[model samples]
Target chain A: MDKTINQKAWFLVLPVFAVVAFSAILPLMTVVNYSMQDTFGNNQFFWNGVGWFKELLDPSTDLGGRFLASLGRNLLFSAIILAIEVPLGIVVALSMPREGWTVAVCLVILALPLLIPWNVVGTIWQIFGRPDIGLLGYTLNTLGIDYNYVSNEFDAWATVIVMDVWHWTSLVALLCYAGLKSIPDAYYQAAQIDGASRWAVFKAIQLPKMNRVLLIAVLLRFMDSFMIYTEPFVVTGGGPGNSTTFVSIELVKIALGQFDLGKAAALSLVYNLIILIVCWVFYTVMTNAGVERPAKKGGA
Target chain B: MARIDLVDLAHSYGGNAAPPESFALKPVTMTWRQGGAYALLGPSGCGKTTLLNLISGIVTPSRGKILFDGADITPLSTQKRNIAQVFQFPVIYDTMTVGQNLAFPLKNRGVPKAEVDARVKQIADLLDLTPYLGRKATRLTADAKQKISLGRGLVRSDVAAVLFDEPLTVIDPELKWQLRSKLKALHRELDLTMIYVTHDQTEALTFADTVVVMHDGRVVQSGTPAELFDKPAHTFVGYFIGSPGMNIVPAAVSGHEARVDGHTIGLHRNYGVLPAGTKIEIGVRPEFLHVAAPASGLLSAMIERIDDLGRARFARVRVGDEKFSARMPPGFSVPDNMVGLVFDPAHVHVYADSRLVEGVA
Candidate 1:
């Protein structure tokens, strides 16, 4: 067979390459350059060769201690939020109205929080948690509770977690709802014919069908909660003795507040790498879960 | 197995107060005896599915009661009805193995594990699904998944009746015959009451002992395939059943003859007089109506086309403004456009207002 390869196709891709270079590659290259070198203001620089990464990973040095502490906090926050959100999202999806006008109303209400800007969400919760004036705080205090997000570490964490859940749980619920909706009515009817209890139906039919969407919900909720910044920063300012100081806040403190560009750049690279690896793992596991062969034998 | 009966059962998606014209299933009263193989056959939107769902309890009839072997089960839930229904599309649990899928219904009913295993094995073997028992059901072919659905329905030995709602729609054409024969064998071996629903007449006629014909939301006729073929009770049945179907043309019926386009065709039975002011027509299957050389006595027709269907030949003929299909006798070539139609008096049925009219013998 005579085959001719087209060389002109390369030119067709040049526009996309140019766009990506300016939008992503160029900024990322600059970060990589900064991460590899030490700078002493006024554009002065020197190569340090993985020194910042080593320190950031270590727990003894000041940068290392702060980075590790905030990383731990970020991991914990991601864990807590995912544990709460995934099941809560599925429950919300299951309880959603199946038909009629109420379905549209419920969908719009579910989407309300997602439409709010990130900073707006942060600001709303910031004021909402003020013990003296905010509804939540005032109500809690009136119920004989010592709830002050501004002063208590536990309260700060609680307020941030609740705020994040309020802001993002809707995304998970909507995805799960979409998955649930895609299930045909035949499945429910079949389950009914099989004499399956409600729980059996959920376990055997609903959960398996929702698997793909729940994976997405977990991945999004995990990444979002891990890199949480504005909400906690606005609500507690990562205060109450660095209780809710997630890694993004720490990175910002190093890069912009302290103007330690090298450290911030190194932290940024590590953070990006972590997210990429975690996302890769999630995608691999989830997509595999969809078509995996747990039993590969005895079939022709 | 239990005998099922639908007593004055009806359903209207628009609610009970809706007009009669809006009912998805017009009031139907029938009995499906135990261990009987029945097929509800009709075109799309003919309420065969509505009837099947009503029996399965997936749909609650808008009015009237359903009984299982004389016990009223109208108010019972689907689970309480102990009926199994396979849907139009395969509805297997994706997470389960083929064996697990087959075992699901039994497990749900808290049947003994050993019995569940044995029953699942029997059903799986019956379906030729033994090799895939440990394989995930979702990984199988469309037909295999459908087999799993069927197996799930059959694994429960004591179901009131196994309902199939066009279960073979997704199966490959080649596999359809294989699966259909397998179902016939299972029906015999299990002695379970199976109600198959489909729009295809061949599937209904071959798979069912009694094919129930539905039209415009009403059960038009329910009889053996031979009965439906030999004597169609309604005009729709006459038109819907046979391959070429029954030929129906408007005519004026009086005494022992039906006049078609000013030509008289003799009838075996004497319909002394049909109701006055009512439209009259005659229905004859192409099998009985033969095409012959043009003659003065026989009803004259203009032959438009002749279709050789391999096994038999048929001529499409026009009598005045009406068209018909008539059997072409063996080796009887068409002689120009003019032809004579010979209608067997024994098979000729007169219709009044699109319904069969009984004549005095």
Candidate 2:
């Protein structure tokens, strides 16, 4: 049986093509244009011919130096958040009540931090970390520890990390919870009948079942943490000596603060490329470790 | 293998002490002999799963004791009970290889590595899963996955008994018979006491030596397939066991005869006085009902339709307002408008309130 090749199916796909072009492809083209050219007022431009990319990539250059530093900070922040939040989220997901109104209450409370606007989270943490009157800082100072987020680099870094973890760990926990709930009751019953220990059950059954969502949690937390700007910008203002300036804050400092559009656009492209490469790497490794990926629709 | 005895065991899904109607499993006191294959045959929601869970210690009985080989195991967990259960859907460790999946139970019990490998290899070969020993369990087809689950049960030598909760449900139709026969062979080879739960009569009759028929939380009847087909203890059994099961007709009973719609009919043996408040009905299999010319048989009936079923022709005959199916021999001419049903008196079974009444010889 041969399928008749009707070429008209492309018409059905035309709308999606148009939407992607106007919303994404066109704006991306503008970024590419800005990345490769230098403009000096009055809409006049000169071809920089990859000069921006070259400048951005060279750590010796001022633009490249700033970008590399922020990139390192972004990588470090992502690593720390992923390491802290993933395990903590899984623990929280495991301890979560399985049923009843308490489940609803816990879920609502867990979701409250996620629902708060990012900048408000920053504002709240800024006021809460003041050693003068705020409870946390005041308590720490009264204990004679000399805690001050405003003047200490380490305190600023700690405050930003804590704020980020407080704002986002619930998302990971919730994803992991959904994954846990998807495991059928039969698996646990079978494990018990097989006389498997609790650790064995977690290792063989629960963890394997949670792998997909953990992948999601890791990827989302990685990408989001790497791009964090608003909260840290509000609290530490990239802080006590530019200690907490992640790549996004640096990009904004170049693009809007100093109005270096060419350099910023070039940095933005590199940042996006890094994210795409890292996500691709993570996706490949996680999927391969899962034995075989679930077959995609219409896929073999 | 161990002989399992349920001593007045009962289960109710309700959180509180439930009334009789709410009980998922009525108090059942029966023993499944060691080295015998038994089937719990019932419709969906007929408490077959509940019974299987109780046996596997997945669900503790609401009341009474479960004894395995004379030791009370009612207070034990499924782990301590040393039971193996294959769920309705195949439960395999997706992350493990076939050999690893088979070795899971043995390893979990702290069996030595060499013995675990030997057991896994032996069971995998027995189940024809040797070719897939190194392959991941998740990549297998449904039937293969099911075989792996069964292998998990077989890998352990210290298991008290093996319970299957319709393990063949996910298998393909063509592969189901193959898997079922393989399971039966495994049972005999291992000499394991196995209990299979299924609603399909063919699955039950073909796989099990004794089929325990359940209905609405009660064991309506438990017997060999031959006994269930030849003599159903209850009306539900008569209506449930055989393909196109026994035909039951409401009748009024006297000492030596039964009357259907006021027509007097003869019985094989006299049933002594039926008790008051008894609901009388006559059960006779279609195989025993003879079709004859109109007015020459027990009760004249109008022929509704005849279905040709390869070897047998099933004729629908209407007696009074009720329809009954009769198995007709090949070349027996079925009348277009009228026929008579001659029920073999030797096959006549009289039911009083859904229970079979003994014939007084």
Candidate 3:
């Protein structure tokens, strides 16, 4: 038998690389160019070596304060979202039926929220959370809860978190649901025969079986929440003060709101690097935890 | 260990009693003895799996009492019933090591650390899975994962029964044979009440002490494999239990004889008082039918095709409008134009209205 390597397979990947480089690399190079130099009016440039990077890191400066605050907020937001969504998703998934037209209906309902655009989700929450006119705010206020997202930082943060949960918990639910549905009924039978309690079944069979997808859900929610801009921007405008301003919001404020393009470029670069670093850590830890250990040769 | 009894169990999915219905399983009443190995054998959608599920308490019976050791447990949840089930496909935790998978039941029961380890080792040794115990179950082969499933079921000795629902369907054919033998040995060694369900007759016949032949949700007959093969209570069982299956020819019965297409086969015993114009079928296994000289037999047949299996030759023959299979010794030559079938009259079964005639056996 003669086996030859087919170099023609490279043709299939060339188009993909071409598109990625054209769309991704060109803008990235522009950002890198801006990050390295100081630009004045009309595109006049001067080299300011590491000055913006140093300023963004210094705690005494306003830029550093906003940067660190937003980073803290982003981390906190991701933690809260994960704490709420993952368990809720698993519960919803387990409650679903295993077969029939009901599964189809539930799947369609679960997927409807994911199909909506992210910006549209922001707009929906914006209208849906108004104190006087919005249904949620009106209901809460009528019930005498004093819900005001505009003036209250806590209310603004809570509303954003809740809105984000409503919009994106479906993604985690769908993923975990796929994991749960893939589990053969045999596992349930085994758990039953073991005389496992409901908690034990969930802890031993369901949770361990769903670990891979849960890790994926955690990573996705972390990245999305850390970089979340549109929904919070539209809903709270990062306000009552800077309480709800995440990293992406602060970056947008530096670039478009303040027009300090050079510093904004540097901050954006640092922001991208931080996300990259965190994502790397997340990927490494998750992949390690999720790694299927190779079978040992001989042990019981 | 407890004997499981299913009393007057009937299931209708739609709650309707119309004929030619769509119910997945019909009414059934049977008992599995304590520490006995029984198999429910049928083709797909034949309700064998449903019966197994009902026995395991996974599904509540619509109309029956499931008694474990003479206590009604029909309404009980599967957990309370203490029945372990190995599925057709592997169901071990992919994230857990094989040792952890085997030890899950023990851990759930809050067994002591030493006892859990001891039981895991015992099951691992029984299943020949000791070498793979520390390996992640997900990284193992399909057969290995299935072995883990089996080991998990066998690890716990306190269960009332361990049920296998076509547990070898996903295994390789050669490996299926090996596993079937291992299961038989396990059943004997452990003395656990085992109910195995499979559509394959070979597995059922080889592994089970009593084979429950099911079709369309009803247990048509429950007996030893030999009894099912030799005296199939229903025509479906007659056709399902053998490789070439039993040959059933529609006939008209008169006195101690059955006449098929103007040819009569005499019987040693009389079917007393059969209806004047009753529709009947003569059933005979292929193994019992012999191809001899045309003049010496009851009926003549035309040889259609000869299947050369290594140990035996199956001659597919046509007798009038009906077709029948006759098994012969390997290398037996078939005559060119005609073949005559000679079956012992004592071995023939007469079925009326799809049920065995009373006292025929």
Candidate 4:
């Protein structure tokens, strides 16, 4: 039998469509338009038709080489942060106090780093790592460690990586904590009765329970770390022989500093595409291989 | 299999108004015989779960010692106690296959792989879960998952006692009886000294050899199903263990007689004396109240209502200001006025102050 249709439901959906168009779709279309065309100073345009794409894809080209090098750097940064933060976050979440006012206090303290403005966090770290007056730098120098983020490439990379970890690991920890909290008491009791050791309990019960949230943490961390710009931009200003210049910083340099709109638009589109592809791959692979977390709240 | 002995067990969550009376599990000493199936039957919040947890060592008792096979195991953890527990909801390792969940306890104790695999196969076969052993536990239906949980308990050869806390609560109604019978069969085959905790009286009665009926955090009575039905030690047990339970009425007793609303009934045993404010009552099961013709019986009552329960019939009869029900056998037709309900003197359990008077017939 044919069912009745309510075409008027489209009216209810119109505002969301309009909002998305203004917020995302329209700007994206403009970028797409810019990516395939050439423009002069005074409202003059001509079809360049994939010329920038050709240049960006060719590694022999300076633009292509810059993009590739920075992409590698961004990939390495994401890998390192993920390796450090995910396990560290799980440990922190597991050790978190399960009851009392102390949980609230600990949560507030953990959230403090995330609450700070990106630029302010950068500024604070810049001062914090100053060799002359800063406590950390002075202490390190006094201990004969020769630490200077301004001139040393390794120091700059280390400081930037440490800063990002400090700034963002709480998000991972908070996600994991929520997952851990959702596991019912019955599972623990059952595990206890099953004579499970601590490691076995963690492996069998706690880790599987946290799989979905852990996936979320990985995806968010990968996406955010891939496009990271604001904090490193303030702290080292992508300095010390471009040791900390990630792909996002490279895109900004081409678009704003060199005033190369066509190449920059292509770069942005390519960057977005890479993120989308990686996220999709991450999602499918993780869901296929990972433990099934019961979507419905409570019970088997 | 090991006998479980609880010596003066008491648990108080505290933060309550006071102690002893306010405790979640009242102080009591009881022993569960080896190879016997026992049920801790009580209403929700009557501390059945608490008692089960204490036995499993999941929750330490606030006071008292627990012994397994005469060895003090109160201070031991659940692992050392060698107890297996299935929770109200299925507690399965979501990442594991049914086979792996069954093998988990043995593997944890470092049992050899061959033995673990053999035991897993045996339990899976017993639970009719052999075909699905390779499937992920998370994908099974509620009853199947519950069966896998039970299978995990059964797979272990040395479990002191396997405890179930309303393990069938999540099962579908149609499968409930099938799973219950399966559990009973498994119990018989293993003779593992199981203790099943449930609020459903049918579950308690049908599954276990002995039922410990609890009320208000205290064990009101412990007996076989027939004994509990025929001779309840307290009014609470009388009212809790049977269908429609025992009709408990407020009455007064003096000498060898009992009075229900100024109507005197002959008592089977003598009451030599009575204290001034002592309250008394008589409990007779609906099954024991015989419907007789008005003129042939001692008291007459007007019929209030009749329920046709297919093979059996029951009529509600008004006795004085109170209403009492009597069960009629199959094919027994009801009279408009179910005038006389002969309360069986032999079957009636007399209570004074909510407890069985010693020597009550």
lDDT of 4 by residue, B44-161 (tens): 9999998998899888888999988899999998888878888889989988877788889888889998788888888888999987777778888888989988988788878888
Candidate 2, residues B13-88: lDDT per residue as tens digits? 8833889778999988999899899999999999999999988888988887899999999988888887999998
Error (Å) of candidate 4 at residue A230 is 0.8
Per-residue error for A15 in candidate 1, Å, reads 2.4
lDDT of each: 0.91, 0.88, 0.84, 0.87
Runs in model 2 with CA error above 4 Å? A1-27, A37-48, A292-300, B295-297, B334-336
Q: Candidate 3 DockQ category? A: acceptable
In model 1 chain B, the worst 10-residue window by lDDT is B331-340
Which has the greatest lDDT? 1
True-structure RMSD, every candidate:
1.8, 3.8, 3.7, 3.4
Candidate 1 — which pairs collide?
Answer: none
Best by DockQ: 1
The sequence of per-residue lDDT tens digits that candidate 1 reaches over residues A4-113 is: 99999999999999999999999999999999999889989998999999999999999999988998999999988888888888899999999999999999999999
Identify the superior model by DockQ, candidate 2 or candidate 3: 3
**A230: Cα error in model 3, Å:** 3.5
DockQ of each: 0.57, 0.38, 0.48, 0.45
lDDT of 3 by residue, A12-61 (tens): 99999899889998888888888778866687888888888998898789
Given candidate 3, what's the lDDT at residue A138? 89
lDDT of 3 by residue, B275-339 (tens): 75656788989998877757854588888988777778888989888999987655567557587
Per-model fnat list: 0.66, 0.51, 0.60, 0.57
